[model samples]
Target: MLIKGYDDGPLVAGESLLPRPGFWSNYLMAICGNEPGASYVPEWFGDDGADADDLSEVLFDPERWPVFRAPAQGGPGVVVIYRNLLGDYGIDYLLTHPGRSHAQHVASWEGDLSGTGLSWDELIRIADTPATGEGVKDSAARLLLVLPLLTDPDLPDTAPARLTAALSEAGAPQDTASTTAEHLLAQLTRRSQHDPTWESPLSGA
Candidate 1:
């Protein structure tokens, strides 16, 4: 039950609550901002609860793809595509087909990306450790957030290189290894924002 918002990542999750109207409004604003003269068209929603099949249909269909491809506004430039199903296909579909005539990337908090190859639970535990505190926690959380998006198998094994690269590019403070840990934790706690390219940045830092 993840409802990612354009204004902020993971607007809501782990609940059956409907997404706030303001969130949708923000998304609409972002779309219009990107395409100045684009007209608003009412989309056909499912009568029954939305399932993966319906969700997949929306993503795969050429007409509907534009809605999800809109660039994120008011935060990171990336678009926020909510996948209620949290399935592999949702992620794979975006990576496979990102629509056309746009240079924006869809950055999402996916999988687990803390430690060399730790599980989500393990990553959380590490982040929650008293010694880790906010800085390290935020770093660890962000890495975990990006874990699911990477196409790497044995994600735990190869994530460090990617994390280090992102940290360096973002000008993350301290040594590469420590900053990577901090970035991952920051993501889980919603203390940071990962750029469209997946570089986690500490907000207000």
Candidate 2:
């Protein structure tokens, strides 16, 4: 079967889903048998640059969808992050916000195997928890740690601003907590930029 990957972190390749006004409600009603409402919009499904199609349409009525010359699995899968407006805005807020919010946002996207259908508010809450276990910890630990220093609670800062600060600000406090925090922060920075939100403000710091 052809699989699609959607993410809400940032625009990146391999994303199949795109969240819009009412994507979640539609998806739930159509696939998961839940009806959050028909407020979810699948903006990426049309013949746009990303060329995303509704999974249900493809599955129920294959004739309407473009014909794939090769096998579905062999064909390229589209990976999309968050498509719902509420979800997207929530994530954006988390990414741009200061304090613990930045950390949780990074962790959610980092640990997200598939970026589609995520709730922005949930991600922000998760990011705040310093101890969310090893899996989530490894996912975006470095990104989360750098947030505290980079964020200026008084001044609204962009993700880049925070990241830049982290790069410049060196020599954090030397203590057990500090050392562990630094080590985890290092893991996120030293890795490659494959994920969607890596370039976002929260990811860098």
Candidate 3:
């Protein structure tokens, strides 16, 4: 019989063995500092028999999202772009309390961002730009950077230009101007219905 966590069969008539967890076994791998190819299960999952309960805790835990601190003076932040149980890509974020270890959810693709002082359009703009020496600012930025690349490949070249313009027009006021030009390469490829003439950031393009 097949079980959720057991992929391998019994070793002997009375002896049983647990299947090793795969690279994609759980969401914690996305940020838990564990390398992807490791065969062992994460300690967070508990013993082999507790797999079900461990999974439940991972899915329901309020602090499940991984946190990344800013390099300079900014507070801690988290940017997670993960596939949900439904196999759809989703994004989430958290802002840490000043001088404290705790943080709170500030944004998600499916929820409100009113508390973040950022808008979806501004996020899309930032995602389009190439990473600076500072790197990506947050999880929302990372999601916007990747989502369009995975979109339908048949979109027209003009689509990205138009989308960029629209997003820019919709963007909120900022303290300073962005140095990079808006990214519309994915849109351009999709709209043109062809592969990029230049190299792509995605692997195996």
Name the top lDDT candidate: 3
Instruction: List, residue by residue over 1-205, the lDDT tens digit for candidate 1.
Output: 1222323233232111112112222222222222334433212111122332343344334322222221211222222244434343122112111233333333443332221122343332332342311112233334323343332222344445555543443333335344443334334323212322333221231
Residue 88 miss distance in model 3 (angstroms):
6.8
Measured on C-alpha atoms, candidate 2 has an lDDT of: 0.26
Candidate 1 TM-score over all chains jointly: 0.23
Better of 1 and 2 by lDDT: 1
**Candidate 3 residue-wise lDDT, 12-80, digit = tens:** 110011122221223222322332343333332222435544553444333332222222133232333
What's model 3's TM-score? 0.25
Residue 38 in model 2: shift from native, Å? Answer: 45
Please give the ranking of all candidate structures by lDDT, highest first, separated by commas.
3, 1, 2
Q: How much lDDT does each candidate structure score?
A: 0.30, 0.26, 0.31
Give the alpha carbon lDDT tens digit for every residue of 84-156 in model 2: 2332321111222223221122222222222222222222333334342111222122333223222121222
What's the C-alpha lDDT at position 177 in model 3? 11
Clashing pairs counted in every model: 25, 30, 6
